[model samples]
Target chain A: MKRNSTWKTVHRYGVYNKSTGAKVSLTGGFGYDYTDGSTATRGFISPNGAWFDNPTVAFTAAAPTKAVTAQNEAKTPYTLSWAPGKLSKKVAVVEALKASGPNFFTAWVDNGGEVDVRITNNGGTYEAKYYTMGTSTQIANPFTASVGDDSSSPIIASEITSNKWLGWMHSPEKRTQIYWAGGASISFYQETNMSADATLLGKTNGAGNTGYTTLYAVENRAIADATKFPVEAATWVASTTDAYEYGRVNASADVRFYFTALNPPAGKLARTLYLDVNPAGPDAGDKAIMFNFSANERSKEYTSFAATPVTATLNKTGSNLRISNGHTSPWSLGIQRWQVLLTPHFTSGALVRLGGTTQ
Target chain B: MIALKADGTVYAMSEPMVLNYVHAASKDMNENKEIVFVKEDGNNHNPVPALCTAPTASRHYPGGTTDVVVCSVEPSDFGTKTYKLRYNGKWVNGLPDMEGRNSENDKNGFRVTMVNPKAGTVVTHTVGGVTTNYVLKPLAVAEAFLPESNAALCNDINFTTVAQFGWSMSDLPSATMIPTAIPNLGQSAGTSKFEVLGRQWRRISLSIRAFS
Candidate 1:
């Protein structure tokens, strides 16, 4: 087998030799060729006798295969790998693979079989491959590792607690009951704001004639405090000679009493005020005074001393009654003493106790 | 009546008048004559008669007569009920007398025997040839439920976390049945249900940075 010469250069035109009966020789820039049995000099020829101006051939290397470490189910660090080869200056790209979708690269490193990758987000499958530089191969299968928000399969949940402060009071009527009675004397004095010691007097005769009783001076002046009386009380003239004087009398004397005030304790409910008079005569002619007092004063009297075997009855009118002086003769009856009773009424109920720590 | 202030102070007044009841002066038959009731329209003054039945005029008799007009009433009538006594063709401006004879017989005027009267219990009173009947109805008491303070955290949750939990007063927990429990929500086993004025509350919050 004969080996063919390599061509150094090629010329566009062919040359002919006239001496030595057409000697054939190959030059640097020309070639000897035979065309239709005619000797000629032409452009350089390839070893395979093909034209030299043909396109150049190219050599390409195969893509490297990749293998990745199992992705962590938690937020931990993991590894990625590729098939070993001549260490190229190219870098390997690591990326995370979305479920059945495209891969997103998080980092890149020099070409190596195995590279460490860190996952900060939720964890899942990952992909890695060698990066191509300045060519169609520049893009590589991204290496990625799965990351998770938390370590548990299902996210852990927390519970919440709360507290509140309260200020509470029971219904006022349900707390406690207050019994109260208040009344004013109907004497000429008509004093509504009398001292605590003011005495109300009534008289009775042997015949049980209920007549007007005398309103003596407000006794116990020494014990009376100025603060107890209203401003109007100071203007009244106190009787000098007969500190105690008799009121005008009639066949049937009727005296009236009125309630001045009714105040119950906090958390207590007031029922009613009961009024009755105590006479020196037999317990034959006393009547009940029925009235209600709240924050205001009342002008009505519920009971009267008209005709009697005076049995105490609940007086709805809240009126004043007369006591029989019980005197057969006008001069026969002397000074008699009588007292009025004022009692408060209340309903029995539960009491509300306050002031304590609660949760 | 006692007035309670927000600062926890109480002020009381004596001789407080009964709400809605008014007094009118009347002519007296004799000096110091006991006038049971009076009616005045700012123009005319009339005295209510002694206790006699319906269709009969009130008669004025000597003092110390046992004859008296009797009527029954309830405790709830104190502030809400209106009474008009009649004498001599005029209506009086006072409630009826409900005085018992003595302590042993305590059933006086306006007896409050039952907690409340049955529906349609009519109370009738005849005076001055006119009879008026009053029907007793159930009393309506005022009630309310209030929050006293902000809910505090009972657990590790902080205020911010508690806020994040979307806690609301409408979602308050079921209160324990006790005297201290609020009405409608919780009340003691045997006690009557009282109205709830207010209550204390609690809440919880949390801040999470690490998992454990």
Candidate 2:
């Protein structure tokens, strides 16, 4: 019951970044210090699964378990997982479950006495409990088949973006190449930001010609070891691939995809939301949020946003901003709710303030 | 693994090489998960003359027993899959096949034969595992596996909680058998037994969860 000692003073603007202002060198390790860089509660290491700033193993300590209710239908899954820090907040979620790839998680079920019972406070002051049904264990991945890289063909990077954003991952070592797999040509990195020849990186791929694409970041180390009971999705790519050559298996084909953006520019806070704030509505932050998005708007863009008031702002001159959706789709923008998961507890307020660095 | 033929004979896994079998990729998973070995029309079935990468092997598909499943066995696109049978002191790739990993409806795919005379196959893949060598009896020639063989429709595999209880979105249910991965097939009634001597082949199919 001790308070987290690593927590710095609450910020009016946003969370702290490894570098100053909203800039990442993009050279060495991308100077990005996590909100919970290295501490017990917010730290990433755990006896179970080390999830310092790991998103898959992160948990939220909100009541009514508000975090669970925040789930909205997604083109991409939540890609979550269990990351215990010797101690965690969410009661029932013993092992962190992934929201992507082969790691599976359905709604509640009955235990029939054979399973274990877990309890939590469903936002109510008192704690709540849940009885998991049918025993469960993690399984192997779906992309066991070796897929030859699009060899003998160099595709225009722009052609890769003209379609539905199929999920992607990056393999470590020298084998650095983008792939468009699935039924059709799945799009990868939208605006290849870097000039050509700037080799890319992402989750490393495995041995079966299936190395990691650039769409995901590994939150832990042990998630890749293939020997375990088969239940770890730490290495899954959370983007959808529209181009399935075997053709799609229908809605039931166990195919799921994901897409992620670079961590918000250090010192800069970005929020992805399902709902937008009405320009003429009651003070912003009054409306509740749903999903997350990672789009950057520009040139004459008009968008309204609402942020909740903590201590209450004094002068409110349109706390919301207007930005262009540009060429991106805000279909399920809810990244704001996603924070650097602190093994046991995931905190949302970890982001830095808008336009301004943490004072 | 050793494949049990219908005639109650134990077909040794003579070879142990993975074969790549691929089907059309579609949107609806339940309907597209089928793999059948059918003929164009009245053709009995045009069997592959020899089923091994190394032409040195004198036998294959009709050589003895083969286990086939509907999956991404194409070694070119994906990687070479393992299709082996048990024989002699060491487990060989001549016997039958393994289970199909694709979980859905391959009610209309086909099963072919493959072999690898090469010793060091792709890592993590081979023809067969362990073998007993005891030949039981011979199996009937199932003309149903040839490309020209009648496209025998497989209509019994089922999934989903709404379709059948217990399988939630994350259910990892799997099946392993000589004929079908799902018990919803014709052999579940225990009609088919083990067989050793056979011109055609037998198959073992298993369906596991690819993702949640």
User: Candidate 2 chain B: minimum summed lDDT over ten consecutive residues — where?
Assistant: B43-52
Candidate 2 segments exceeding 4 Å error: A1-61, A64-359, B1-212
Predicted candidate 1 versus true structure: per-residue lDDT over A245-347, tens digit per residue: 2121232122321111112212211111111134332132322121111000122112121221223321212112121222122111111111222211111
Q: Which candidate number has the best TM-score?
A: 2
Ten-residue region with minimum lDDT total, candidate 1 chain A: A159-168
lDDT of 2 by residue, A1-359 (tens): 11111111110111112233321111110111233334322222111122223332223212100011111243211122211101111211212212222211122222222211122222222111222221222111112222211222212233224532222322111112223332222222211111001111121233311211111111321111112111111111122221111111222211111111112112211111111123221223222211111112222311122222122111112211112323332211212121111122222222111110000
Q: Clashes per prediction?
A: 107, 133
Candidate 1, TM-score of its B chain: 0.16
- Name the runs in model 1 displaced over 4 angstroms: A1-190, A194-359, B1-13, B21-94, B99-212
- Tens-digit lDDT string for candidate 2 (B10-98): 22222212222111222111122223322222111122111112122332233323233223222122122122222222122232223
